[model samples]
Target: MPVTDYQGSTSSPFSFGRSLLSLRRDTTAIMPSGEEADLEAFQRHVASTLAELLPAADAGAGDEFLSAAWIRRLLEAFVLCQEEFRVVVAQARRRAGAQLPVAAERMVAEFHERAVKALDVCNAARDGVDQVRRWERLADIAASALGAPGEVHEGQLRRARKALTDLSTLLVDDAAAASGAGGVASFLSSHRNRSFGRARASPSRTAVAGAAASASASHFRSLSWSVSRTWSAARQLQAIGAGLAAPRAHEAGLAAPVYSMGCVLHLTAWALVAAVPCPDRGNALQAHHLPAAPPRAAFPWAPPLLALQERLAEEGKRKDRRHSCGLLKEIHSLEKSTQKLAEAIDAAPIPLFGDRENDVREAAAELAAVCESMRDGLEPLERLVREVFHRIVRSRVDGLDSSMHNAD
Candidate 1:
């Protein structure tokens, strides 16, 4: 189905009678009326912001689709949706006399469970970013070796060859794993069920492990042991979506927003796994990886969300993308450029001269350009991933605190 423009949809949150917002309005009649408006505004803002992530119909999958910048925008949208959901829920609880209805509270708790799972996905994505950075460093070394003007010497050729070889090894290992092997899964798993109301220091161990993970490209071996051999991004995504369902007709008021936020969270995490390296992403990339598709007609945000999902899934099915380490556009460019450079280096005569020399130079320059794009893009992407991590942790803690306070 063609993606419907959220701004033009008759069922958008702007009009109340024909959609889920209407039911939400009915449910909130027992509370202060302003709470319903806040909830509606929350859904409207989510739809509009997410719609911005959709590419134009005629657009190609260039830097704007699943590129680093695009994924950052996706995360930014999720952050907004999360913050708004928190406010709307808190307001609903207040208007209902310091407590949500039993059904709404259940939905809130379920959303928090998904939020906790997302934290682990965030950490895994950070490692993937680090993995890409390591590749960048190696590529830079290769590019620098061949960048000098005039006749290229054997020393330069040898240095470039070694760098490319190392890069090839890293790429092969990464793809063989079918997702990068490193993550902070064990560290986060320990605190998985901890109540958010309790205060604690940030886990220094994670910082130390991340530092180690970011070490020189040669230390790629350490990544294999950082996370469990059995950890799979696909399973983690499945866990998040397990038991997730739309709110029943009687579960009104806050239920709709809770369901909306849950969908946002699941999509955000799934997309990260799609774009970044994570364990067993081959399985994660499958058609059945997502929870059964949510009804597109039932929610205003569904069109844009489904559109993005369909596009990413199409990218996954492409023959060129099948064996790739990650689906991020830069990764595709990285692999292609690196391969051309590697092939050029491999096919060069031992002494290197004439057209062959120019070929090597041309390939190195192309790889260098790809490396530069990654260098500029990966840091901001990493920062956004880190921000996502902190927000999920904060939201989970706040939700837990609110739940405890209400019980008291």
Candidate 2:
């Protein structure tokens, strides 16, 4: 049957084959149609394509859901496309002479706004990995309960539970560090090490200081590299502003250094988070006695840095809270489904005929039902992933196309 027919049919058990086939068809349909030149039409096309990709109830994929790896790849693609769009916009702005074209400028500015929003969407989707992992655990539990081998399934569940615990700890630490409250011990310890290096004449002591500096430098480099695309884009925008006529640039909000400053602050907070020692390491280090380093002279930039740190911490808290709420919802759904599964298994009819054959058949049916329940719970999350992918791709493509047209 055609894919559309499957969509309208009564709900049925999940099937991996049908889900895969539908996804293939929907992805193919996302390509731009020749007639969709208008912006609204293009957006409609993208939205429809995304909607089409939603998981189907009758589509059999009982054991599978979208993977975090797949979402990461999609986000990477989105970021690369945004980078390309930024390049095109910068080039166009540079070529615009004394007076920028109002329409072109507006279009480009809108594109910039959308690109920023797209990044937020992508980040949220990336964080949704916890939700995906939770669903996977539930499915594994259901399978194991329905006669899957105990040893392998138990091991998988144990590992998954451990990962979730680690993730929660990391998020809490990250939120604290971002807020400036969590990293003081590590910072002070590193500072003391630096001071000791200056005081000690021994080669071994000096080497320790050098190693600390090297480690700090490496951490900074890694953090910068992680968001290098955003930094590069910000610089390009700054360059465009520099080249524009002063009045025009100021009117465009490009003259203000806010965008660049925001990017730098973001990078700084990320670096701090990276530099802070994990709780375990910090606890271990604090056990050793060392002389306190003399307080360093206050920097002129200290106030602003403190404020930025506070803001970043707040943002991190908000994100963590959001994820927690989502996780709670998932847990609630899993609980309900699990209760139902237990009831179904208890109520399942005993074999009047062949014992082994009846047990296998009943177990398989119960497993399928459990899988269906899990898939139903995941529909909202799957839709969210699809929508984010669509928005990012659509915005970047539209921006690139607009820039190219204006250049012509």
Candidate 3:
């Protein structure tokens, strides 16, 4: 059905999909009929993209919900929406020429600012992916130690226990930091092992100490490479959502798509912060900071998007997950396998028995599989995040350069 049929809901968002047609029919309008077609197409694409991401309620256990593959698909959808919006914005500008409304300009400008904040989110998420990789390595160590052939040996168990211990420490620290008991510094310090390479023999000890301190300071300040030590995913999301609202009445023509894009941007970024381990990752899912679920009746895409949001939120709230470093499905699988393997190691009698030895090996095999999946998925996921970051940059630059050319 054409989205206009849903116009009986709230006036603003429902008006979003059909606003161009309303403007064309009710009054003289600036958007060309062809541009109106493009806007409608954009909304429909958004709807279909999100609809495809929603798995059925009875989806099999193998379905990839909140998994790395699912997140990749989400990023793909974001890229598609971004590409379509870029076209719509460019077409609107070309048609309007020098007479573009001030409100439309402001809406686009606001979206640009939000897009900048999302870049920081992408950077943090990349680091988070790196963090998960670190965990995967530790799990691989444990898995290898336990999965060795022959009877389960004490020496092998010792190595596996040590790896699990270190993994536990990191996980616990992250949980504590996310809850505000500690902050990102402690969490990052756990991962940073090396110092500045050996200082050359210096004439003065004081100079050497100063240089070392400077290097350490610079390194710590740039904790996640691109984000600062103080950068909180929670605060960054809040910054992106601040002052965001539906487009004002007069601005609904071009402004409506701008508003829709802003909402998608916020939702996508928020979902990344939830799935990946970021500084203050736990608090990033706070409901108030989330884009309020658009009315289901108001937009065709609302139901599926909201379904996914609700599913993620429910996962976050799961009793075992409240303190989880991340809500990604593989992370959950990793944690479960590690815990079970740890328990098996702790409970086993000396020289190991049939079921007990089998348990250890089984658990090891499961953990290894989880690590393998992460190995295959994370690099691609990080690449997608980087793509998102650069795409936003290119769009902003193109928009600014276009405006300058028009002024000239």
What TM-score would each prediction reach against the true structure? 0.80, 0.29, 0.79
Off by over 4 Å in 1: 1-33, 57-63, 179-218, 224-226
- At residue 141, give the lDDT of candidate 3: 93
Residue-wise C-alpha lDDT for candidate 1, range 128-246, written one tens digit per residue: 88888888888889898998787788778756755655566567667767743222222122222221112332556434433333353347656643346787889998998887787
lDDT (Cα, 0-100) at 362 in candidate 2: 54
Model 3 TM-score, 2 decimals = 0.79
Candidate 2 residue pairs in backbone clash? 14-60, 14-61, 15-59, 15-60, 15-61, 16-60, 16-61
Clashing pairs in 3: none
Estimate every model's Cα lDDT from 0 to 1: 0.72, 0.34, 0.70
Where does candidate 2 have its weakest 10-residue lDDT segment?
281-290
Better of 2 and 3 by lDDT: 3
lDDT (10s digit) by residue, model 3, range 1-408? 112222232122211222434433422333355766667666766788788778667765444788887787788778777767776777678678854566677677778878988888988888888878877888899899988788878778766765665565566656665553222223333323211112332447435444444453344334443577788989999998887776544545676677678777887998899988888888888787776556676556677777877877887788776767787888878888877777677667667888988888999999999889889888878877877777777777776776676667
lDDT of 1: 0.72
